[model samples]
Target: MTDTSERPRADLRRAPERYLSRPEEGIETRHAFSFSGHYDPKNTHFGALLACNEETLAAGAGFDEHRHRDTEILTWVVEGALAHRDSDGHAGVVRPGMVQHLSAGSGVSHTERNIGGAEGPVRFVQMWLQPDAFDAEPAYGLRRVDPAQGGLTLLASGMARDEDGEALRLRRSDAALWLVRAGAWQPLPELPSAPFRYAHLTAGSVGYRTVPGPQGGGRSMAPGDSVRITGAAFADPVAGEDGAELLLWEMHSPVSYG
Candidate 1:
């Protein structure tokens, strides 16, 4: 059952505080929410998001075929390349600056592996979102982005405002994913107002602050850090000296499995 009895107003989750899982040699994962054997009833989900995982796979290692249904899976590669193959006859190589989305409508089976020719270990962040409708046709989408370009780029969305052909389409209308790659000391764009918002730092550091709320204190966020905002807005984050890459989610509501 979906847990909605208790929820935080807003909070920061640091990198080291995440749940660590090393299912096999050369494969490491850090989960932001309850997953696999790390279950937290109060922390089962935030907004429509169910899982936010940071994964690293050594050369020639990867996840075997797995099945999923009624979930929207999004992946962002941090370094190296990820090779994907699925039951729907879709195959591709996703690298940094690319967005990969898989919609497990009714059901789908897939496998992900670090490319054998990668220079080193492959690292990526993968997130799962609950879909609004079930048993629809499965689909796949891939898009390459120029992170150096200024401003927030719409990566995936199901909202009416994003009906344009720019973003990968999702099956849920209450959520959207955005990306920002800022230069050193650059101010980020204003975030979209929503009941629930989550920001994950995929690369570099930033000075961030939540606005119009008790958790308004300025904070520094390193790679793997995340901020969860509920019924509040966030001030524009400033990139650190080394710059920053962020993946932000704007959701109007939490997940409901009725």
Candidate 2:
């Protein structure tokens, strides 16, 4: 028995204003939790997730080759395109409706560029998660999920066959990710619905509540805002007000209790 006690509850309409916003000349980012210069020891992680960063890059702007180790990095492109180059000899372009997953098992270096000139800016949401396994190998994969796949598309899964042949595999076996575009109300996929779950609004506004109760009041979530579900629950997205988009992660935490 460890780290247990509080009865499962839920938090909703959690504004993004409390998050750390890092802005630069060409890049502007709003971090969902403590990161870079922002530090909040108590708010370090949610489930198996660590960081959720909303990044916007000006045309011809980008991130230089940076290093990462023992992290499962997943990126969802919201607009325009991103040029990616990594140490594993994988180079490609990721656009809207596409997902870019990079698994830095032992270590890896990569770069991301908007490639779009001053005419267009690129927007994307990137999430970092702790892998279940460590120091395995560096790998990378990409997939473009269309609405045809379903309202909820499996972007990345650590569990084998969790994606039905259309998802990217993560080196870590503790997490699964889903992305939803605005349209018909959709049910959550079958995953470990833990006491805590993370829901991020990538674009537009959405209607969400808890699995059994009205946690969010079935209210709306503005773009850039997110919620933390404290009970075993899944949300049904009923509508997408102005091109809505969502990213949901379901996983078991390394820390457990009796």
Candidate 3:
């Protein structure tokens, strides 16, 4: 028998689109974890993250104004533009390559509509996480990302040092989100022995290695597929036949759900 101590252990899971949300609506939504009416104890969350939903809006259909509290909401546009209006006096349109972050601290109400551009329907991914400090002020912000930028870009972070280069800031001090467009090998930051990393392939396919050494395994990813990395660091991923588009999040483990 092989020795158990000879290798490092990591959990690599593939989250399919149909696993977490109702797929029957015109405004299609496929959740990656427990959300709304779909609940799975074992699939609730990872680290400090609570929800990641892949959403597509019909020509004129969209979510009416909704309310949230004590949550950090991030909306990453994938296809068309998303018209967003919030109670914080911020009304804007988020387009592809742009990521919007809304802190529903204390409490806030917002609306997302496809009112899509000439491009047609609107597609995007929304993630929610608990803020380290609850009942704080509500806030909203956005950032533009370019695939040619190379390497992983820190779109949002809870890191104490502002010099870390993430400007779309987070009120929570326990999580960060990154965006990477991998055409070639682009390695990730060094991770601790026991780390919590969530890698989502929003577009194109990706070939990723989730651990530090050769003993670790890799997977071919498709759009909407994601992997949860634990106890190991994910190396730079390589793009498949088509280049890859991704959203990566690193957070403190035993995810806190709000």
Candidate 4:
């Protein structure tokens, strides 16, 4: 948890790539309907949380059926729309305002396709979380969000809530996600200051300030950027503005596994 009194700061990190495609399920792509992993094990934290910064999937171009086992995957639409089909006989469309979760416990097969029109491309985020337990049972869920409501909304949890966060309770390790839309310069409300903190900018830009570090001050980032904070600095404050749309993830340290 970052200290409430300390300001949030960050450092610049070279982005990463993972070859995830329709064929090998390559990690990163930049050509047509491009998909890129802003940060992943190949770049940052490997086998922990696969954060693929995806954007602009050409219309009609999508992934074919693929299998996944013992992985907790979440698909977040930052801009356009994406359609999903799974072996469980479930199918649905996801737009910019919503997130979809698929828990491939033992094993599950699924595919994603662009739902945007010919002229419009699909832009979104795909994350893979290593489960603490294998083959927990396959499940699917979704959560629509609006940062205008203020504070964090639990997108998926082990328990049910009365509102939007009520869905997506997994049987593996516990984790929660939140979204915030702030001006060019605003502070995030105090949080539990958990052991892990990750921020991804959906749109706009912001400056993250924190205690003096090896790089001097802090770091600044534009849209499609991400950051991971750890060590005792976990409690340091991080703020942004220029109307940045930020996605935050708090996970257990050491990334527990069963």
Best by lDDT: 1
TM-score of each: 0.93, 0.85, 0.85, 0.76
Task: Write model 2 residue lDDT over 163-244, tens digit each, in one string.
Answer: 4567789765666887766543434334346555678877777675655555534666787778766665435545553656
Across 1-258, the per-residue lDDT of candidate 4 in tens digits comes to 122224343434433322334333322242111224232332434224544445457667777898988777777887668889999987889987788888888888998877746456677777776666675778888777654455555565442332344556654444566676665466555543545566666777766554445544555667666666542342323455456676766665434434
Better of 1 and 2 by lDDT: 1
Residue-by-residue lDDT tens digits, candidate 1, 189-220: 77677878889999889886656545577778
Superposition TM-score, candidate 2 onto the true structure: 0.85
Deviation from native of the Cα of residue 104 in model 1, angstroms: 0.5
Ranking by TM-score: 1, 3, 2, 4
Model 3, 53-114: lDDT tens per residue?
88888777788889999889999989888999998899889988888999998999998898
lDDT of 3: 0.74
Candidate 4: lDDT over CA atoms? 0.60
lDDT over C-alpha atoms for residue 167 of model 4: 50
Error of 1 at 159 (Å): 0.9
Runs of candidate 3 with Cα error greater than 4 angstroms are 1-17, 20-25, 116-119, 146-149, 163-166, 184-194, 233-236
The alpha-carbon lDDT assigned to residue 130 of candidate 2 equals 84
